[model samples]
Target: MYLTQGLHRMLQMNPAALATVFRGRRRSYGELAARVARLASGLQGLGMQVGDRVGMLGLNSDHFLEYMLGTWWGGGVLNPVNIRWSVPEIVYSLDDCDTRILLVDDNFLHMAEGIASMAKVRPVLIHAGDGPAPAGMLSLEQLIHDSAPIDDMARGGNDLASIMYTGGTTGRPKGVMQSHLNLWSSAVGRMAEHNITPNTSVLHVAPMFHTACMARVVTQVIVGQPHVFVPTFDALDVLRTIESEKVFDILLVPTMLQAMIAHPDFGKYDISSLKRLTYGASPIAAPVLERALELMPGIEFQQGYGMTETSPVISISGSENHSAAGIANGRVRSAGRPALCVTVRVVDEAGIEVPRGTVGELIARGPNVMLGYWNRPEETAEALRDGWMHTGDGAYMDEDGYLFIVDRLKDMIVTGGENVYSAEVESAVAGHPAVAACAVIGVPSEQWGEAVHAVVVLKPGLEVSSEEVIAHCRQRIAGYKCPKSVDFVNALPISGAGKVLKRELREPYWKDRKHGVN
Candidate 1:
């Protein structure tokens, strides 16, 4: 099924119903559909053909969505540029995809010009931001207003829909190719699993370039839910929106949540209107969860677990699992039951299934799994084999089917010849009163080959010593897994998606020298 079919259905059901509220502009499904259609026609008129790759470089905006959906509607593949990436990183993705039409917002106007200089094929430029379009670039409004609506679905089912570039520890980014079917089923399956209905209003705070948040947007369209969009996430702005706009639900990573609650005016916001807060992209500390519960007793926290390749959702720890009853034990730490359409298995090094309660490599098989890695057949074969997508994450399932993510297979530390899941140590350290956030990494040690190191962030006005931190962790976990050394930072490095950037944290220690991790 075409992913854009929701737009047509929404327009038919309620032409006047608000479909998007972005940057003080409200567009009903009727308005959104018309713009999307005309924009598709505009791209087609500009020589875009079926299977052509179209690159969009911009921050979150209505124009970005219109351009993306329009490109897909015209049977072209979307290549959304990561806004946080450097010029070279952006160039790599665009050049790798062989995209020829670069749709740029004001923020990237200059960068787009620089990219144009290095492109294998000269790219046609379309400007898509407020005020006057760039002098040398084609104006988006001009293109849409001058063209006729085109309704064509040349690519469907397993056809390439979009290519998302995820961070590559391999020294270069890899494009994960997702099909129309992959996306549609991800949206439908997640919606069905979460009970996200027309009455639900999802806040768009995470960057649109992220497949996790973008998939949520697609689901909103299909369910005809009103989406309240923000230019970017600001904790105070988010609280204000919830109080004034009565936002029912939102999604964010744990780091974002930690910052929000830690904001000075956090207690001042009226947040009783919120119902579900879906958290993912990183693990959340139990202390943060406890504080959030105390501050907003009415909220239900749903934990999401996935990587970009699985359309970013393998399971969601739902409302029932977030209850006070579930928090007493370690149940709150679980990532919840797998989504209806997904099958998860914890496998050993030999590719044999591990029993429940045994930690092993997490493998998945579902429609939500991507078609393959873009233009990398060997890599694709390696990633998607034996009828399952290997997640490269170590995890286990309880008898009740609750998934517990142990650690990334690459991130698991081998210290003193003992296997240690960094997540376990981080979770324990995070439970301490003085610790606000932390990252556990393996550092070089002459004695142990690799020693466990903890980089921590403490609560304001708190005095904590590295020795005390080590002692606290030592009591909770094996001494080998506990921090042999600790560094107190005001904040840990975080990625564009808001997850703690463990790789960046480890870079200081491992940059000039190398260990095993690729």
Candidate 2:
């Protein structure tokens, strides 16, 4: 079934049930369905053809959900712009995919002017904000009010659904092509593992731009359950919302959870309604997990592991793996076995399966695998060789099929649940006029799983401070991708072929660490 089919089913089954709640506004299934239909018709009327890519740049909100459903209902593809990306990065995605129609919230209206100027063809803007429509963009509310409901296009099964841009190894963002089937299989497989009830209410604190959070959203829609949205992740807001809204299940990164439990006023909130807590993007520290368990004795904790190429889930560490015994026995450190619909293998350089507990590249073949990287056939072939997605994560599968991530085969840093490629950071750092050479590496961090660290060699007679280097990189890339710490050197160690030996630079920091990432 298509993603929007569940919405139709909900309309027929429980029209009066709560569908979405954002800020203080609530919408019943009946109201949401009508608005979604008209929005779809309105999008089509504004020149969205079948298979056309429609873009949305916004935070978590009811409008963001509506934009997602309406785009699919109108038979168009989706491109969820990363909110952390700078103007140049956003424009590159819009231009790369030829995205002509864009929906912007009040938070991103300021970027519209810069995006319009940089893009090859200025997109047709639709303002999805509470305030009045800006100069040249059409009002989202006006579009819905002025249009007529249309039929569902029924796009499903291998149909191109989304083009999600992810950090790439080649110093640029790679658009991951996800089909409807890819997303559908991921959500259904996760739900089967979780066994979420139809009455479940999920809180959306993670950004919708992320595949992990989007997977959660898809599962909630399939089960026809209520969704509670907060504009963004805040420790106090999450605590208050769980108490007041009675949120049943919520997905968060370990960092957010750490902040929530560490909040000074955390004990003041009556959060007994929270039943399940799902976390992913990076491994959780033992102390953090122990504190979480101690604070919420009745809460079930789960962890999922995968990348954007897997449509985001290959294996899941279940609630059972979070028990006191499981944690004590070290099962909590494992990424868990394959999901119900996925096949996972740890393979060596010769493309052969390795012995249990032998570190190797994790490869997966499943319906949830992405179609390929958009417009990069060579890169796609390398990643999807032999009909399996070769995940660049170095892992070892135990005799019991529990996967333990040891290192990243590719030099990618995952800070606070965001992937920051070393090449991207290096490129940004090397662009500074004062620098001659640079190498980026991931260093262990308590707050972030890994923080991006940069080593630089300045040009002759040139000087640059660490803060200045960080500020320079921030102008060119996202803040998370910038170096958390910088070290100035006279010269970098290079091999005969002129490649910087990043291993030498990384060895000191990871000398005593068990895992490459924290």
Candidate 3:
């Protein structure tokens, strides 16, 4: 069961079924397949060979899916660029993956020029959409229209399917190699655990570029359900779509859920259409969960916990525990058990298993594990050991098999379902002249799960203010990674190992809770 195999199956078994609803326009499976075949032929005609990498840079569109399937149909690897990265970051990722063909949308067309300007090797460009192609670049639609239909490339299991770049908290982004088998197994396994079917109408509120939304799409395809794509998540837009489109399922981060429930007009929409809700970018606030429960009763809530390396699904807590857990029966706070066909164990630094309910590093082993990080063997080997993907999450399993995430092993800050590494933010913050020392950590937020909070010791006589510090970091990193709030401290507590004690920083906000976080 390769990743591309589903497209062929859908084209054959359910040609007329709705595949994607984008920007209020719907595309049927048959129409999408025909288009994908044409695009595949066009790519093959452009000297695309088996195993060559093709890049995609764009917002969510019907064409994104078309190009994705077309790449695999043409026996190529898909390397979707992160639209959030700086120009240099984007160019480095493309060059690292050795991408020779790139498809760009209107929003990202300027990036093509940047890549051409910097990359030692420039890829053939194809502009995505109805617009005319830029200088020296062919329009994607024109290429598809002029080409003959081609059969599926028929790449089998374990074949390279994609090279997704995961932006690290420090240093450069690493390309996580994904195989057809990894993607297919992840999709099927998630649907199995969540009991998704063709009857499901999964909502795509998150960006498809991110692994969370991308992985969710696979299950919807496998179950042959229609996925409603929203280019980005907007609280009201999500509510409107839920009520209007009757979205049966949605996968969001805690921040998105909080915003949806807290929206002033949240009660305006009839959101009973939601059958299952899966969220797990970060820990959920108890208040948000209670409010969501109050608004939408009888809703199935599930939480999935994993990183990009684990094909993203390590464990899932579902309806069985959503409304009930222990004697509480429906406690929806837990992140559930290890997924089907997945092995999860909490381990210490020595790779020794910890006792049940003891916090430690979470390790997962399954077919869903990524192949390796592209061009970084040392880092890849460090992450994947003994056939298990080491998920750098601080978590523990209860006697009931439910997992609770206490913190992160890598100081990763998950806000709004997006990961913001402190190391990355620290690098930016360190550049400022006003700071003597700084530490970035997650603090409980009403909107975002754990907002980026920075504790800084300013140099003597420096005129830097909290706003100025955040403004400095914002210019260097993405907006989401910038600190939402700041604390001026005389000094940050350090442990014997010379590590800044995050617990000491986190205690003030979370000391009253049973756990360190809400």
Candidate 4:
């Protein structure tokens, strides 16, 4: 169950096999293992003790993979910072977890100063980019080159492996604490159901910081397959990488998949080697799925459904459900049955099981379920009750045990594969001087699956333009969290209890849609 066990196995059985390929830089298993060992030793040399948190604020790269394994190998927990978050959000997350070592890449070098100044305890900044280390930052290459290789710490089982932060309902971020066993169970369970083809390389287009992609990294490591990476998702780069690297498997959000398929040069590359494609984070539009099937004939398609708290996998709709017959039968809309490692049940507010076909909160129990929310006992108790993780998602189960998600009970928005809490956006929107009140909701989006929309009521005798409102939010929150559209209204729809009626506001945008979510 150790995270580094797979690496050890590869080193013993196939040390010479290709381990990673990143933009002209490739490494064998033997080389990667040596680097990970040295990186672990370097962390130890920098006074990183067991159970200390190490954070990385960087885009996707082979170095990101090393940092993940290196931290665990040195007996430390991981805290992968969201690259899209504003400086304040990044600082809050780092401070919340008491992360002492922070890694920054070229893309985020400008933010390092802000983060260091704002964080409660300044972290040791390590430059993880390919370029030379900037002033006041330690070079990752230098550390690995100078330090001696260390032995594996062998921390596993109930040991805390990562503290992934997700958008919070209370206008903050909640760290989901996952154990090594939790992650191991998830990857193995998924691998058992959707077998990875032997000797096939998996492309890493999705950001490695995300749970979905990180879970894939674990699965690939367990199978001892080569990993290919691009800094971020670019349609042409993905196509070119697949052609050059012979990438056989990939996981993408519907938005990325749509962009890649809709690219003008899509047919210019030889992607015949691609075997399986998995999509999730948000539901896929039928047209996109159909077009993908048409363009890439014989490729297996699977849709996964889960969140960070469940080690990111709860159910999977396999290739069978993507077939023409399945689509015609309406089974393609399902989130699929319970995963192999999970026990799922739809429950009422009182925790009683609901009848099949009735939408209720989705509850699951499994080793893959996260241990708890870090340092938030009350929230942890509320989410995990009686040995079941009560997912705040509105969904229904059918007679055949398939789950169909209809709405988000927590009022979270999934835009372009990123989760944005309405409360967080509303808080920012309300900060405007001319804004007397505001409510944020997720609206249907053709490209992003969902877009954040803000409905506002200006203070009496005050006026604010939509552009002004959006510009104000940009300063307070991440650009993705900023409202894509702002509606100036005299008053927002309200319920008897005085809470803003978000459903009413969302109705116009989501009307006639099969599911409330995109």
Which candidate's TM-score is highest? 1
Candidate 4 residue pairs in clash (backbone atoms < 3 Å): none
List candidate 3 stretches off by more than 4 Å: 324-331, 412-518
By lDDT, the candidates rank as 4, 2, 1, 3
Model 2 residue runs over 4 Å out of place are: 411-518
Query: What RMSD value applies to candidate 3?
Result: 10.6
Cα deviation at 142, candidate 1, in Å, is 1.6
lDDT, candidate 4, at 161: 97
Model 2 Cα lDDT, one tens digit per residue, 372-488: 988999989999988899988888899899998765666767899986767557767877778766778999999998999999987778898999999998998888889999999
What TM-score does prediction 3 earn? Answer: 0.80
Estimate candidate 1's alpha-carbon lDDT, on a 0 to 1 scale.
0.84
Question: How well is each residue in 1-518 modelled by candidate 4, as lDDT tens digits?
Answer: 89999999999999999999999899999999999999999999988999999999988899999999999999999999987778998999999999989999999999998899898998999999878999989999999999999999999999999999985434588999999999999999998998878679999888888899899999988889999999888899999999999899998887688679878899999999999999987655555667788999989999999989999899999999989887898888789988998999999989899999987899999999999999999999999999899888888899999998865676878899987767568767877778766778888888999899999988788888999999999998899999999999988764211235676788788778887853
Span of 10 residues, lowest total lDDT, candidate 2: 492-501
Q: Per-residue lDDT for 31-119 in model 3, tens only?
A: 88898899999999998999999988887777887888898888999898887777788789889988888888888777778887787
Model 1 ranges with Cα > 4 A deviation? 152-154, 512-514
Q: What is the C-alpha lDDT of each candidate?
A: 0.84, 0.86, 0.79, 0.88
The residue-by-residue lDDT of candidate 1 on 450-471, one tens digit each, is 8888999989999799999988
Name the lDDT value of residue 446 in candidate 3. Answer: 70
